[model samples]
Target: MSRIVSLTASVFAIGLFAGSAVAAGDTITIGIPVGLSGANSVVAPSVVQASELAVDEINAKGGILGKKVVLEVADDASGAAGAQKAYDLLIFKKKVDAIVAMETSAARNAGLPIVNRGKIPYIYTSFYEGRSCNPYMYINAWVPEQQVAPIVDYFNKQGAKTFFLIGSDYAFGRGMLAFTKEYIEKNGGKVVGDEYAPMDATDWTAVLAKVKAVNPDAIITSTAGGAPNVTLTKQLRAAGIKALYGNLAVDEGTARSMGADAEGIYIAGSYFTNIDTPANKSFLAAVEKKFGNDLKTPNELSVPQYEAILAYKAAVEKAGTTEAAKVVPALAEVSVEGPRGTIAMSKQRHAPLTMYLGQVKADGSVSIISSFKDVDPGEQCPKLK
Candidate 1:
């Protein structure tokens, strides 16, 4: 199997590919596989921009290990096949030293085998289902425990006893809801309604009607990404159910896009554009300076991409090499100060971050209402061998 894999990689390297001639040690290439076009496109720009910001900062500081950092971007098209193809290109053709990815679980799962085969250090920068254990993979985003538990606790404390749950019919959505149900029940709350919609679902009339009928004390939604999230929020507001809406998938950028519809919605995550820390303020100012009037509001979903790149830089510098074997162990000890705070990678290859709970104000900006400091990922991934 190893011989066959090597032959295939050799063939790909010699084939007609744009970046196939890229030599190792010349530059530290970080591949970014994201939904540049498709259902997830709404948030993709922010992901790319944040990553670029990190690269610029690192390069300006004399690069990492005296080698300039560069990005090799590939469009995942919001699908599993696209992700697999993008990963193959990055690993076999472009020969990127590391990968910073933001995609759905299906896409990530599809690309995992390729990552394992190539032994490249892959940083998954997206809020996802718990327990994604892989030898060559690291997660820099919130897992279920870091994201759901705090929100559930906050809702329960606020007298939200009966909750309605809705999400896209996918691994991430279903898995998140499962954790949410457990947290709600553990907190002495009941799930009044549990439902799901397709990834591209646009109309929420039926779901809204059912939600009104259930009349839950709070509505917890994880509708996939982009248009689906916006559609669900808009329809919920149109229905005027008046129940507290707790959104696990809505980020600051998406909330701003929702405008008046986003008002009063609840969200919990590691970063928000309006977070009042000096580090956060400096990060936001840097973004504004780089992108100027074209800057999009940074969100929890996108900021992790920036943090992931920085984490990789720190690990590589500490390890004194970009080889996956050396960097993988160094990653466990690497710490980077992000907009959220000082985040360090755990032994399980996930970051422990500070979580914040906020409500979208009338102007579509988040108002921090509660904060959970230094929340550990407590990941279920098996220890790397």
Candidate 2:
């Protein structure tokens, strides 16, 4: 698959930056570092498409602060080494003004120091483990408090007393399960089993057998990224485990891809494609019009890519310049009404977003059953100001 997609006709090639002397005022460049291969490849295309949609829309409205926005994309290839290489190329080689990145914690951790040294604004657009804070970096996705606590509360109300935990063997998976266990125990529930598999592992026979042996009231899975998530869910259904299933990592696109196997699985996130609000409907229509039927359904993982670009544009317009020192503080003050409703960047450098709890219907779409408004990330970072 091609790592770069140029939305505008006048996009400059990544190699052009090596010799070309360009003025930043002519066009603002936003670099996108995404996993175009490996474990995360299943969802990377949607992230890129969503970002292009946002760029097109912003350009249609005369671009950001009178300058057209262009995307310079680099493939992360779904690993730390790949992420480092991509970030280095985007920051030093391409000289992009800002970046929107979607990858695992390992990749993000590897790339953050480079971004910090460059002092370019980076918007991380994935739901991740909490307490990640760095200068010039902003997070647009839900953290543990914004996503886990509400879902656990809802599950507790549904008579789920004992829970089983499963995840990929990594920081994101382990960290999320740790938070889930904390919330479950704090809410008067007990953990019956906890298990983890490698991110690329496809075999889940033993894990499903353990779930059957434990006989927990509900099962929470945090399998990393796309393929592993589908494998785990499908295997669980095949084994006919009767425990209520709550998926912390499955997005709407992944759920739809699962077809009938995704039915009845519960999930919580900041956005679902089926949300009926005017803002959400507009976003869906724009996406459908832009990408037509070729694109997969937008999900929590992909939609935030669109929102992050819009937020960056807002911050740039408010600051009246693309300089990181000015835009970083401006980002904390700007809010954009996106598919997920009005999202404001917090003083802590993460969005204070709404949380939606839903279950997958037989048709592989989400039906929103409950929502928590204005959920804060609850972790404080160094103030950008």
Error of 1 at 217 (Å): 1.2
Number of colliding residue pairs in model 2: 0
Question: In candidate 1, which residue ranges exceed 4 Å CA deviation?
Answer: 1-24
Candidate 2's residue-wise lDDT over 211-327, tens digit each?
999899899999778888889989999999988889999898878878899999999999998788999898888888766646567888888899899999999999998999899
Q: Write down the worst ten-residue block by lDDT for model 1.
A: 1-10
How much is 215 displaced in model 2, in angstroms? 1.1
Q: Write the per-residue lDDT of candidate 1 for residues 240-309, one digit (tens) a residue.
A: 8898889998888878888799999888988888788899899988988876656767888788899899
TM-score, one value per model: 0.92, 0.92
lDDT scores in order: 0.83, 0.84
- On a 0 to 1 TM-score scale, where does candidate 2 land against the true structure? 0.92
lDDT for predicted candidate 1 compared with the true structure: 0.83
Which regions of candidate 2 fall more than 4 Å away from where they truly are? 1-25, 382-385
